[model samples]
Target chain A: MKVPCAIVGSGNIGTDLMYKLRRSPVLDLVLVAGIDPASDGLRRARGLGIEATVRGIEPILEDPASYPIVFEATSAWVHRQNAPRLEEAGARVVDLTPAKLGPLVVPPVNLDVHLGAPNVNLITCGGQATVPIVAAVARVAPVPYAEIVSTVASRSAGPGTRQNIDEFTKTTSSALAEVGGADTGKAIMILNPAEPPILMRNTVFCALGEGYDADAVAGSIVAMVDEVAAYVPGYRLKADPVFERDTYTTPGGTVPARVVVLLEVEGAGDYFPPYAGNLDIMTASAVRVGESLARELWRAAGLSERDGARDGARDGARA
Target chain B: MSASGKTGEGGRPAFRLTDSTLRDGSHAVAHRFTREQVRTVVAALDRAGVPVIEVTHGDGLGGSSFNYGFSATDEMELVREAVATATRAKIAVLMLPGIGVKEDINRVAEVGATVARIATHCTEADISEQHIKLAKSLGMEAVGFLMMAHMIEPGRLLEQARLMESYGADCVYVVDSAGAMTIDDARRRVAALRAGLSIQVGLHAHNNLSLAVANSLAALEEGADQLDGCTTGLGAGAGNCPTELLVAVCAKSGIETGIDPLRMMDAAEEAVRPIRPDQGVIDRDAIVLGYAGVYGSFLLHSKRAAERYGVDAKDILLELGRRKMVGGQEDMIIDVALELARERAG
Candidate 1:
């Protein structure tokens, strides 16, 4: 028996997931939900030969009377609004927002725990990307301090990200503490709306308090990131900058800045390579986590729709 | 009487003034100062007790649109020639934030160069700190320069100042290389640089809007002892506060400038004389840049926009600097210029 699933948003991320799921074997697509009448989700559903329904939050929450699972792709606040309704109706929900309605998940760190939970929430994007690196750091160097700077395209960033700037810090810290095993990671995130958009979440300056196996630590971090990215998708590593320079004018004169370097290592060593690898691993892990949620939502809904038609055909033959 | 009620150079002071002609001033001319002319000016600044002669590389580490021409010069020869009768006065060189390593820095410091100024722009303080630390580590008399001081407040500038000072900066300079500051602002900036840092404060003025002399003098009066000058005011955007004027102002007032003022004027004429006609003279665009306190980088920017979007350079420069430019619109200016080029190309 297939579990009826509902995809509650048809935005960029949602649409991409739908195509991926319809082609996959594990899950069925049942209901495609949306908030706007003008969403491409409705048109896409029709193109996929899936049922087209008008958009509303109430309809999606009510869907579990038939569709018994929900994938919430709304903002954190909206997830909070829809969480209890979906859970009480006996539908397990997976949320894409930073809001933690239930257990937070990343496949490498908590895959089994997430599968076991009736409702699961993926923490902030930074949590998904940097947790593995943090775990790696603890294994080899054991840190007293860590910070990640996840600069994003401002337009692509979710709502409440800018208006509530403090929330970005709070959410990042809370998520890092939960995953890193020490409630002490800081996040300084920026939304650079620069042209020719750069998509990189760079983590810098992880000071590891001495005593541990740094090579083993880096390996573990890389493994976790690779594992998560394999299961999910869309996470990739970018460049590492060391000895960065620019021109600065001071009261004295215009002096050229010839060397500025920040290094992250799991041990007492000071260099740029360790932190560069750490940042790449962590970011890749987080992006994959998001990818996995999309896959699950699309599969469950599509399979459940198929199951419904099959049941109807069998009933007619028996009659 | 000057606008400040006195020639703001109103000071009795004793210090060798160094005009960064053909060096820091290279940015005004697109870093292609003719070889003969560069040699003439560098030699002249040395002849005058302007003492330290600084040469090219306005933006270090591939930071600028082009590299400085000094790469072609035999650096050792250039250094020796610029400081013929080496007194305590030295040949100074500058670098941008990310271009060279500690080994490279030590090499420059060893090759007859006494001071190496490493710089970072205002928004890049967090990015600039580590480089300055490296320069200090190399045992170079490292001076950290923060550009576009007008865009940032005194307090925020102080935080960076203190850090550079902590990293062993012998001097931290406030650079109005943009020429966008008033005399009062210069004083406040000088105070800010000295407030939290133990290092001495230096002032490098750009002669945009004819305010360089006033601002530099104001900075000196407000406790800045280290200052930058250029012979014949040959520098970026209008140029620098004149070495001759500073020395004369210092000398006529019975101030103790070790520099010989008359010697500096003679050097200026010698350096100002015609070189190969193929190498252009003081530019018209740089003059306009000084009058408006705008960067003389408009031409380079246009050239870039042209390459990026395949449009003509002249149009991009004109539209980008039009009224839409702001107090700190460096990033926006480039973006708009590129956009204009794209639009025209289409």
Candidate 2:
């Protein structure tokens, strides 16, 4: 029994998420909602035979129990307005915006902790790409400072991304500290306009505390990249993480050792082009979180995994 | 030349001057501008009839970080000092969209910064909309700054500038951040903006190709309403157009700038020259910055990386230019240098 899921705001992100949800085994995409009647995303969803609405989140609100999960792919401002209403309707929200209405979840790092959360905030594209690596290093040794620079192609940045550039930096930075286990964090984003738009690139810099084992840090980072790649197939390290004894001056004091990780994310070409890895990683992570939430819901209702699969097979046979 | 005859009251050219010694010059000095230096410079520029004085980190607000070098004194402290010292000049601050945020704008506004020059890469003006609107909402004059303007053609640049204008930018600038534009490059861009934009058009030139003043003259001939300069040309790369020289030239060319050239010269020599003894010379690395079409702020960082990695700084610059690196990608300097070193070893 795949739980029903809906996506709000049929913009670039929402449209992309629609394509990714088609491949999910545990979640069924029921609705694609947007306020604009002439939205291409809603039209595309309808063409795919999926129910889409022009009434925004009202369709999900009218029959809230039908949608056990909803992905909010709208702007931060719009998500803030829709979050409380969605919660009142008892729908689990996987917020793709930087609204930060609930606990932040980077799937590999803290999805288990926030499994029962009513709303799980995927911080930003930059946060999703770099936080796991920061968490990996933090797991090996204390991270005094972590900074990230996310450069994406200009063509991939729609109006929503452009408007939330500030939120992207702030939310990503805080997630680096709170979820990535850094004492202080900073984030920078760049919109590169090179012709034949460049792939999404991120550089993660972490200042390590004293007595850090280099081998342990490297092993942890490689393992984390594999775990993230299990969902985001195109996510990979550009090269080995560079470890050096470099000095970093933070607001607190100087940090002795540093680790630099370079990452490139190529989209799976679900809806957008391959250069839009920034969007791909977000939707992929949201799907992973939604599936986890669905399993949790089944458990809470006293149904085992084998029983749910048997019921899904029986329902398929009936159809 | 006929456009040079356009004048405001008192027979002065209808042009405003913004001195950037305290802001862009920070990059040349490694972001080590003390509060006293800001005070002295702001006081001198204010007394010399400079209409505006911009003070901030070279990379703008929230720029003090591990990627970009940290400021010696807090940028807010420097902003406060500049605001307190300036009596006649309106204080301005630079806010790159991705490097800085709305909170940075609010903080600068609270400290009496009346003008917010919101900057972005030449092709990415769409990202400046929110910040520009925020600045205008805070009752600050928002200027759209297009850095590295040579990377795009005039028609496309006009389209980007139009986005800023629609977002409530009071003025827009044609910034040669890499000091790479020729005189015609500067002219066509300023002409395109002046012809297209209803808002004011400004030109910011760097002297890497030895064309900062020539390009400023071309912009003036094309009806540019504003021009930026640094006292003694103390800025990144080959520095900016020297304020003292620009004023003296304007005074001699029968163009009225409403600025006392002698006072400006006094400010440059007495206030700014002592800070950097060999300021603004178009040396080899500075020339390479223009030749490679790389960012001006990358000059110092590239040199440091080259020295540490035992590779050529010019090679690092050319590679960065080849990669089409933008303003906020300063972290790539070390990455590029490391790759070059590895290649050399291999």
Candidate 3:
């Protein structure tokens, strides 16, 4: 028996998930609903012989029996309005909006809880990157305050992100609340207006409570970052550098971050590098976390159960 | 009646604090600040007891005329507008001679400025004569701004300071435009400015070294009479001594800065809102650019070059920096070539 799944909003993520879904033996690639028929993702899905339609997105969410599971990958505002309707109809919703309507999920960390939910909110690319660091930091320190500076090439953030920029604070906090606890959290987001946008990058500054050695804290941060990065493919620390004060330049001409590590020790410069590296590591982790949540939900939607029967066919491509 | 106290000669704080944001920060965003923002900033500075503000760009028209420096607004309008708004703060305007010498001095006075600064690169200052003399003739308080104080020899800077003083300038500013100078370097430059000239000495610090406060404090300790700052350290690359840091440090050290150092928080929040990048900010790149002895604006160029070349932005920056590329110098290879020519001549 095929576990039927519908792909909603055939954008980049929706299409990629569609391709992955078609390859699964247990899941029926039932219908692809796109707001824009001309979107390249829908075109590609149509070419692959997957059922595709546009504009009347309601058809997929009209009844749960039509498609047992729905992947909501539209703009933030769109997802905020669409996710509830899909969930109410009894189809479990996997939302890809950066909006915080329900819970934000970074799979490997929050998989146990969200996998059982009727509706799950996936963190934004930035949230996916930083949530793990929040988890890692909470493991070692009594965090009183945390601040994140997330800079991305303007191009990397979509229109949904821009519209929900302010809510990024609430959305990120909700994700962090699930795993990494902080007394107070602050995020400063920047979008570079560069004509040809650069890759997404972020920097985090965290202040742990009393009796904490910021340097040791920074070390713990690096280890935890390494843990999360391991889960995040294509994300690696660009530099393992000893940053000097205010000179964030590395030996390889990479900008060595300027930092003044504040410890109870007063004017200490020791904790800056590991702290800097951890920020980068955590930020990349956030992107992977978002993707991981999407994959996990689809698997639990019973595709894996069906994949088992056709194991011989998928075994060759399992890797 | 003094805003802070009795205005009996030398009673309120010797020199007023001036935020050179629109002027120096213009180096970062190409002086994109609107007239309305400028007016608000001047009002905020006025409320803070900042008595002098430099409205710049030599008729606001300098930058690379046929090339790529910050082309300022019309000198008269830029100065007059600020002067009209901040009646208490002396309206001061800056002009880079030869860049705007012919059109500036008389127009600066016409625009209602009370003080005019004549700017020149110490590496090439002989050509600034006509502009400096014109400011003096107009009876405006004349100032000579010598940029990139590190790139030029100390002795040469002293000579230039002496020349500006002799040419009837009221003050000489040692601008560590790169924010690269150490406290020691700042002290030496300030001392040199003071020792060689009868006019007051000033320091315009950048945060490239993250030492704007340290350097400015050193200059003051060494007897420099004037200092420059900004709202939220929001100028070019890394920004300058945060106006708050300067005031706070000065207050903590017993120097009389009539402005409330705390008001800086208000200023910082106001000025940095529009300019901050999305996502990661005031982070590693800022710290690195500070250490490299340059402004943050250059990073935009490096980032551009990196994206275009599909290589590392940091590599692009180092290559540009090895040649001493100034932040506002977009066609900077030419400036590097000029430096080469000067080195050969020397």
Which CAPRI quality tier does the interface of model 2 achieve? medium
DockQ of 3: 0.01
Clashes of each: 51, 0, 31
Decide which is better by lDDT, 2 or 3.
2
Model 1, position A78: C-alpha lDDT score: 76
Label model 3 with its docking quality class. Answer: incorrect
Ten-residue stretch with the least lDDT total in model 2 chain B: B1-10
lDDT for each of the candidates?
Answer: 0.55, 0.91, 0.58
Q: Give the TM-score of candidate 3.
A: 0.46
DockQ scores for all predicted structures: 0.03, 0.66, 0.01
Candidate 3 residues lying further than 4 Å off, grouped into runs, are A1-319, B1-11, B57-60, B64-66, B69-77, B271-290, B295-297, B325-328, B333-346
Q: Tell me the lDDT of candidate 3.
A: 0.58
Model 1 chain A worst lDDT window (10 residues): A260-269
Tens digits of per-residue lDDT for model 1 on B1-346? 1223222344433433556765655554555555566566765655565666775444442222212212333334445555554454676777653233334456666666667776655434443455566666666567777766665688887886776677677888888766768888888988777666777888888776677778877876666758888766766555678777777776675556667788877876666524222222334444444444454434344455456556655554445434323222233333455466446656
lDDT of 2: 0.91
